[model samples]
Target: MTHTLLEGKKGLIVGIANEQSIAWGCARIMRDAGATLAVSYLNEKAKPFVQPLAERVEAPIFMPLDVRSEEQMQSLFQKIEKEWGRLDFLIHSIAFAPKADLHGRVVDSSVGGFTQAMDISCHSLMRLAKGAEPLMRDGGSILTMSYYGAQKVVSNYNMMGPVKAALESSVAYLAVELGPAKIRVNALSPGPIATRAASGLSDLDNLLSVAEGKSPLRHLIDLEDVGNLAAFLASDRARAITGGVHYVDCGYEVVD
Candidate 1:
């Protein structure tokens, strides 16, 4: 029997596009653990996709959200407050880097591409964490996803690597800023996993092969691993863990 890890928690999970999305995995597991889910779709164009995924996760509150705009972020949170009053957790499973930047050399990355990538991929979490703070009456967990490219060089990762570096740093700073309030902030960094997001990177084929072969697990990272990790982080089990950029990468980081 699967015991409900989050028996009475309520939280928002932003950025699930489909079942293959890491956000979807988190939502599924979070729901299974008895958490009520509030989901945010990025835009109208995404509504069709987000609606179905939210249904599958049994998410009760679904709203439109675009992290690039403060208005949308504030509006979404405002609605959440009106409906739920308080939130127990927040999952920031959102990130984006342009296809052009991910397929070329870092030197070839343009100013526009770099800014767009960082704004959407990194700044969004900082925005959400700031926005979610007031409503977490009971100190709760805030989670964001990160990739291995942030710490080590991965060919064709481009500007997004720098963005993830900034995001990883934000986890620490937010952890410090929110710690006194009992809020925990952390990032779950995972290795290669085949999903729509990974499709943008040209090196995905070889990247997965190398990660699977060299990592101690000798297998590609799985979404189940990520979902379970999310459940643990959101629960009181990890109350003492904060501001950490924890690796869920099947021992890949330890290998030289």
Candidate 2:
């Protein structure tokens, strides 16, 4: 019997909502590789969905976390440290923008939407990275998800593009700052993938078709693809790779 890539490791997979979730894919693969799991769902309303998924993966706990709330961030990681002593990895699979904001032009994006979008999508990454620092004393990887729209125009993505741009920037900054501690920070800028979150935005199905056409592979990205890459980044295989915004976008960024 042989353990695998993530053997002896443990991770916190935040933002899981359901079985179709990107975080759920990452959670499944990482667990398969032998890392233990802790999940974080936003509220009571989301608990039923997140709980069963966590149970399926043998995740020990599913705590409440709303990243916008600093109290929740601190309390959540404190629980991790108390129970697990420290962490080996963390996935910030959270991002949000109001539906109205996603439908409107960026120029038409309001002050509230801009604040909420950036706060939830970008700043939350920064906050989580900082919170994870102390408990990552043995050195850990912090990974976040981004999209091509952060670099180029993607209609109806609207304010989220800017939020992701800020997120990518934060990845660089956090990587450099956490380097001496032996922690890595990076992002996976994935191409279009159908998930519960993506379905929330308007015109996504049509846009996904366009993504398939533009992608060199002539196909869409999948949670498994992103999951494999994420596990690699969170492991010692990526020891020297920090501050990188790695793309799993099927070369879609190349053309556009």
Candidate 3:
């Protein structure tokens, strides 16, 4: 049984590539919990895939946002301000790196590739937090997706390990900066769940298999499992929590 935990809450979800995306999972659960959501797609190529999911969740603001493009981001927030008046929460679920860099040894990664990954995966949260601060008049929760690889070395995880480490660290810093304003910032570190993002990684199946076997539950987590946790963090039930990396990995992080 689910509860209306986010009734009257408004949030923006910035990455929904497809139905299998972790961003989509968080959007679905938050909407089901009675939160009003505004969702975004990367570009025209992605809109067809994301529109139906946005519609399914009844998102009122469906816009295009490429974080690298300040114009697009400004337009998105302008729309939100005009339509919703304020934002209660935001979910940053976007990350990327050149395929060559992702599959190669981090030591050999190109400067361009490493910089791009850090910009997209880590610094974007800081950008969003800056944009969201003013609109969060009543204070709110901000969530960004992360992985175990951020803290521990995982085979085939490659450059993302360092990229996510920076993201988790930013969450802590943002939490402190926004605490006085009552805004909470957090990173949701989930075990590998075979999302579109993970598909880019090498030996994804092996990663999943290893995680399932090592987890205390002996099974990997799914999209909905992550969604359930995300919904909690976004709601008032987690009001006391802020500036931390919350794991939804079924104890996989605890294993030796």
RMSD of each: 1.3, 1.6, 0.7
Q: Which residue pairs in candidate 2 collide? A: none
Q: Would you list the C-alpha lDDT of every candidate in the order shown?
A: 0.87, 0.88, 0.93
Which structure among the candidates has the greatest TM-score? 3
Better of 1 and 3 by lDDT: 3
C-alpha displacement of 86 in model 1, angstroms?
0.5
lDDT of 1 at 58: 78
TM-score against truth, every candidate? 0.96, 0.96, 0.99
Return the lDDT, model 3, position 199: 98
> Cα deviation in Å at residue 186, candidate 2?
0.2
On residues 1-256, what C-alpha lDDT tens digit does candidate 3 reach at each position? 1658999999999989999999999999999999999999999999999999999999999999999989998899999999989999999999999999999999999999999999999898999888889899999999999999999999999999999999999999999999999999999999989888999999999999999999999999988988998899999999999999988988999999
Regions of candidate 2 where Cα sits further than 4 Å from its true position: 1-3
lDDT of 2: 0.88
Model 3 alpha-carbon drift over 4 Å, by segment: none
| Cα lDDT of model 2 by residue, 138-172, tens digit | 89999999988888878878788888999999999
